[model samples]
Target chain A: MSLQRPNEKLKSDVLIGVGLRHQHFTEALTTPSNIDFVEVHSENFFAQGGATQSVLAQASEKYAISLHSTAMGLGSAQGVPSQYLQKLKQLASTCNPILMSDHACFSWSQLNGQQVHAGDLLPLAYSEQTLMVLAHNIDRVQQSLGRSLLVENLSAYIQYSHACMPETEFLVRLAELTGCKLLVDLNNIIVTANNINAAQPLDYAQQWLAEIPTTMVGEIHLAGFTEVKEGELIIDDHSQAVSSQGWQLYRSALERFGKIPTLVEWDNNLPSWHTLVAEADKARMIAEQVFGDNHSSKVTTAMTGLESEFIHE
Target chain B: MNNNDAKKHSLQAAFEQVAQQQQTLISAIFPSADSEVIDEFDPRGMAIYRNNLLATAQQALAISFPTVLTLIGEGLFNYASRELLISSPPKHGDWALWGDDFPSLLTNLAQLSDYPFVADIAQVDRLRQQSMRAKNSVIEQASLQLLATHDIDEIYIELTTSQFGLNSNYPVIEFWLSHQQRVVSDTAEELNQKFIQQSLDKLVQGDFSQKVLIYRPYYNAEIRELSASEYAWLTLIKQGVSIGKALDIMTNNNELEHDFDFAQWIGIALEQNLINHLKV
Candidate 1:
């Protein structure tokens, strides 16, 4: 199959795949339905010769791969590890992923002349200095990989006291300054809203959608979150089913932002392959509902070895 | 406040301050605290941090040490994990590489110390991980041809990069394999040492020290359980002994039969890509 361009607009019906776990690798690769793209965790494939690379190579021949990362630590004070970035770049070159993205959280804290693995993506303060640090990091990442990186907003539990602009503005400014696209995770927005006691997260989302340049939004993420107690909700929990409220918010996002590449992430308590496909089908249905049936036809065209020009305006 | 510097310093300071107070910080975000932060708009903010921290750490441990998690059910595993985290917090950004010390931590647990196999299982788990991420090397077919030049009784052989040596005092490998056959049923019951000793004796013939050759010619890492004699033969060969010298030692010790098919064994090793290069 011919390679597609990164800047090309994917069809509205396009449903991107999430990281494939060992449990679902066989089913995912052999499934009868045609998936538009397959995403993988960069760290999972760091091994030299393993089943992960073998399966990914096979899958790449059949589908477009998106190399998503969990350990880039792009926003850390110590900055990105050179070895990790080099390895990731090498993997990207070999796999030929369509896009690369990582969380906007810092996980590293320098201590005693060593960069230790903190095991978690800690929250960051939304300030100009932090923004500069992020921008420099993003620039380095993009330059090193020779590809524009997409930074996904993390779901945070705490907010800093430093007076600053809203997260939406911060992200928009970062994208504007660094020339990186946004991977708008609707679940994170919902989680942040619940954490902050925002009366209307949907409205906040709409405002964000309006403020951020639509062209800069490369992809969207939808995941389920559970309500721990009464009013608090955690996004991207990787457990439970995607709530209707989140789906509704997604629909609203589609209406405002138009068709964008979307992924359904069920990382933990992952169900069978059929369950994941069903979730993807749900996302596809929403896509069709907002963008019309012609969207799927275009998607089919792209799947059957057609050029991007055929589907794009 | 020159708009830029003020924003940068203030935000950095706030984050540093918040991260310092782990408990109160989580309570502030999560609002799951017994009481709410009345002054701030974000009440249950800390709860998010707490949940994320615990959940991420739990998930990392769960992935790294599946056998331990399985031995203890999810509830108890979570409890043990929480205790472990409080004592030894994660110090890095990579979650996958996190919990490198979890196996040792579990071994030190007074509750878990009775099961001597737990630590060995952890060792096996780490070995599996190392095998997965180990560097790639190509085995040479020419290396096997050297075996044909010398008489079976006179040659010393060597192993190459495609091989891995695992030395263990316990039947950790067998324990892991059996545990994989069934989900751990009860954590409250004490391990039966007599039954374990019998099984270990049958597997190792009362030999506590054994050498296993782990090599991956293709995709999966294959473990070949070697006898003490075979291990010695392989070790000498791996140390660059000429094929003739290695075979002489094996034959002198009666470790090899007169009719022992050296060619067939060499062929199998070649097919498995265990041979990399020849010294002679």
Candidate 2:
């Protein structure tokens, strides 16, 4: 039930990976040569008897893995859902993922007498009020999960008028008060800055990362977005390839945070397995360039036996 | 409650209210919701989140009931799914096993009156999803020799949680298989319409009975057709009845006019790897 088992060997340097989408599961079973790790949405594998679990068991044999979730509702008033946390803890124990994380926003709320899932990640106000809420829920989650979890900052569409504290201070305070680290999604920062007219988007992202030191970042996520509504709002749809601007900010983030575990999060319009591995390779190249010889071989000697047979292919 | 507890409660209450109402969430959080807002805070921004929430629920339904979508066509299927979202939002964050109520909801749709069989057929898809999610029992291999060794009255058979058999008045199996994408017919629409008519004709002729057995022997969903009496015997075994009691019930039941061969049914079940194991 203990959670702090970091893969120091793999975590020795920045490792690259992609979200394990269903389209890529079969090819992933082939255990391609380049993938450093594979991350699966925790909710998808909650059911123990489905094909998702069978496929994940085979994939975990050959590749390093992580567990990312969007249903934690870290800011909900209904307290922590023991059932959701129970299943998540089971999956984490079974897989022993390199890292476990969920969004920093609320997705559950109490409506009348029933607990309702908002069906999407809803933004939380970055004021003194929500800061305490998020911290308390994170403590409960970390206690039950038996690990220090990582929380990703959300991409907001509107700034809160009543939220007295800035978003950076809120994230910093959460990490300081509770033991959880930040998941630092680079693309979300870009999308939010452009939509909300924060100074220059990349500069805004760099400034935010500057506030949190390298030790506090657990992981980084890069996903795609498109500006719709006459270029007024940038939606994090995850359907397209990551934009050129996103890549630039990603490089800046790597320079700021040094070498943290990074992932390409293409959730919707998923590409073929080969194409996804290539995107992970692209993240690898950026990390290598930024860190400058602080990294090891691109394809490390982690797999043997059956993994060797397929990865070599 | 302490100040922190009270603050959290108010934040959650406000959030729950905004989810049900219009995107007044922005206005509640920031007065920018009312003004010609700044670049990042468009009033229409809430609509995008609204669409994403609806789309998430729709995609979940579409995944669970792909055949139903093909039967109703994508456009109308999208319409029906959205309507269901309006009528019933998800009550929890864990939606992996959601959409069990969808088949009943589909049957109540006024637009689907012409395709009354669609709802019943959709039930098969739900069964398949459930069967896939059912706990996989690690059963020792079942053998007729082992089963024969026990006195029929004294023996009990353990069935896996992943098996289901249903007998319906509609040609549910035919309707389901006809809509599956594997059939490779360019005129699938025309074929579906013809199959629908034939299914209805069979129903009117009082010969439209379809028997289906769904199970997840392996990790994947496996479905096959069964004979009428075979369905009855399997249902009895699934209910934990002793083999002797099951046979007696089958023999005593005068309600079923069409008879089935037990030996042939056992052979079918064994070949399909349907039974989990034998017990005494």
- Residue-level lDDT of model 1, residues A143-215, one tens digit each, is 9998898889888766677737778788888999888889888888877776667788777766667777767
Model 2: docking quality category: acceptable
DockQ for every model comes to 0.32, 0.35
Which prediction has the highest DockQ against the true structure?
2
Model 2 shows how many backbone clashes? 2
Model 2 chain A worst lDDT window (10 residues): A304-313
Clashing pairs in 2: A195-B40, A196-B40
Give all candidate RMSDs, comma-separated: 7.2, 6.4
Residues B147-212, candidate 1, lDDT per residue (tens digit)?
567554444444545466767666665555545534334531224444355547756656565456
lDDT of 2 by residue, A20-97 (tens): 888888888875456667889988888867777788888778777789998887876555588889989998888878
**lDDT per model vs. reference:** 0.67, 0.74
Q: Lowest-scoring 10 consecutive residues by lDDT in candidate 1 chain B?
A: B24-33
As a whole number from 0 to 100, the lDDT of residue A286 in candidate 2 is: 66
After the best TM-score superposition of candidate 2, give how far the Cα of residue B171 lies from its true spot, in angstroms: 1.4
Error of 2 at B1 (Å): 11
Best by TM-score: 2
